[model samples]
Target: MGTVKVLVDDLLYYNKKDWNAKVGKAKKDNVLTVVSKIKVKSAYIYELISGMYITAATKFLKFTSK
Candidate 1:
């Protein structure tokens, strides 16, 4: 699995892939394990290990391969 680091404070988390619902927040500098990735239109979304969803925006996240 890969990893993603939150680049912005209080980044929003979604409970679903559509990103229509807000579930929780992840703080800046938080490193999350990425279980999978999906593309929604022009943006990418990551499914975390904890089953939370976050945007893969470069301005808000930094991705790394492991």
Candidate 2:
């Protein structure tokens, strides 16, 4: 398991790894538990325990091992 801190306000979270499904939003500085990491195309996406997907880009999140 891992953790990630949201770097921007109202960060978009998705329901699918394809990023075509809109789910909800997460606030900045919110630390979330990551269930897993997936690579879609050339981008890495993180799957939260809540079943939400978010970008794993360094500019958007700060990742840490738990």
Candidate 3:
């Protein structure tokens, strides 16, 4: 899954009900949410031999999952 941060118009009333109401209105209007910024994070795993099972798993997922 991926995530993005966006900026939205300020609520006329800074209350839970008002905020939810504005959000529902925006959704119904198909308002586009602008992504102001993005941050990505990843991890690297290293294995010397990658094991038979690991290699087989990769192959199966790559070739047969479609």
* Model 2 per-residue lDDT tens digits across residues 1-66: 899999998888998998777778899999999999999899999999988899999999999997
lDDT (tens digit, per residue) of candidate 1 on 3-62: 999998899999988778798899999999999989977789999999888998889999
Q: After superposition, how far is residue 25 of candidate 2 from its true place, in Å?
A: 1.3
lDDT of 3 by residue, 23-51 (tens): 22111112122212122123211111211
How many clashes in each candidate?
0, 0, 0
Q: What TM-score would you give candidate 2 relative to the actual structure?
A: 0.90
Clashing pairs in 1: none
Q: Which stretches of candidate 3 lie over 4 Å from their true place?
A: 1-24, 29-33, 37-66
RMSD vs true structure, all candidates: 1.0, 0.9, 19.7
> What's the lDDT of the predicted structure labeled candidate 3?
0.19
Clashing pairs in 3: none
With candidate 2 superimposed using the best TM-score fit, by how many Å does residue 60's alpha carbon deviate from the native? 0.6
Residue 48 of model 2 has an lDDT of: 91
State the local distance difference test value for candidate 1.
0.91
| Stretches of model 2 off by over 4 angstroms after superposition | none
Q: In candidate 2, how many clashes are counted?
A: 0
